[model samples]
Target chain A: AQSVTQPDIHITVSEGASLELRCNYSYGATPYLFWYVQSPGQGLQLLLKYFSGDTLVQGIKGFEAEFKRSQSSFNLRKPSVHWSDAAEYFCAVGHFNKFYFGSGTKLNVKP
Target chain B: DTAVSQTPKYLVTQMGNDKSIKCEQNLGHDTMYWYKQDSKKFLKIMFSYNNKELIINETVPNRFSPKSPDKAHLNLHINSLELGDSAVYFCASSQRTSGSIGEQFFGPGTRLTVL
Candidate 1:
């Protein structure tokens, strides 16, 4: 079955420090990758997505992800983490209209 | 205004009870979807409708029934709710006709708790 994997279950980063979340997928063809963030008591919001064309895509909230086809990975990164960035991040892969999401990684930003 | 909205933000029911959650979107998109987020915050696609036509149906139990009266509305009805059914349900819409990267707009989820 096609699935997305997030190696780290929980990650803690200090405020103003750099942050990176790992994401990998298993798919047969070129996959459409997406990154979403879910804050406490809030709905999931789209951070960025990679479909085709460029390998690197920038999204809202100063976040970006690079789609590496050879490694089958699309990792998210931020130069400086904010306290509000503490949320559950999900990596999803799909083609056309179908989607498969990773279990998710919870990021905790400590001062 | 909220583009996509769901009713009954929180629901509590007993086992074997039947309930329904309603979702509506004003995005004017061609496709709508239903997703379930478990306790672990893992979001999984359950069903999807494009212009009132069923498009994607994942591995969900038969007890869960989805109804779409119009392109703007998609509702989920569950019969004989089980403990496993307890989770947060989200409704999303997307422009399926878009050329390449189809972006989805999601609504505030409906959290269901079974006692």
Candidate 2:
């Protein structure tokens, strides 16, 4: 079965420090990758997506993700983190009309 | 304007009660979906409809039934709501094409609390 895995359940990063959240997926075909962020008491917001072409996809709020097919990974990163960046991040794989989301990783940004 | 919207931002109900959540999208997408987020924040897909046709149905209980009156609207009705059904439900929409599978647009979500 196709699934998405986000290894870190929770991560703490100092404001202004670089950040990286790992994601791995298991699928048979070329997967459509996506990153979504959810703030406390809020709905999910799409960060970025990778359908084809460029491996490095940039998203809103200074977020970017790189899709590595060989490693079956699509990791989200930011050169510098902000206090507002504290939230839960999810990785999803889209197949046909269905979507599979990872458990999610919570990021805590410290001032 | 919100591309996707859900009604009843928060709902508190008792077990055995029946309730429904409505969803609509203005993006004119061809597909709609329902997802449940548990207290632990684990997200899972429950159902999907493409152009008002059921395309994907996860292992959700039969008590949870989805109705798509049209391509732009999808509603979920839960019968005999259980305490375990307390969670945030989100509505999303996307456009499916041969070139690319469009990114999904999510609503603000409806937090359901069944006591």
Using Cα atoms, each model's DockQ against the true complex is 0.60, 0.72
Q: Write the per-residue lDDT of candidate 1 for residues A25-80, one digit (tens) a residue.
A: 99988888999999987788999998789999999999999999999999999999
Model 2 CAPRI quality:
medium
State candidate 2's TM-score.
0.97
* Number of the top-ranking candidate, with TM-score as the measure: 2
Q: Clash number for every model?
A: 0, 0
DockQ for model 2 equals 0.72
Which model scores highest in DockQ? 2
lDDT by residue (tens digit), candidate 1, B1-115? 8899998899999999999999999999888899999998888899999889998888899999999999999999999999999999999998875543377888989999999
Worst 10 residues of 2 chain B by lDDT: B96-105
List runs of model 2 lying over 4 Å from the truth: none
Model 1, residue B39: distance off in Å is 1.0
In candidate 2, what are the lDDT values of residues B2-97, reduced to their tens digit?
Answer: 899999999999999999999999999999999999999988889999989998899999999999999999999999999999999999999999
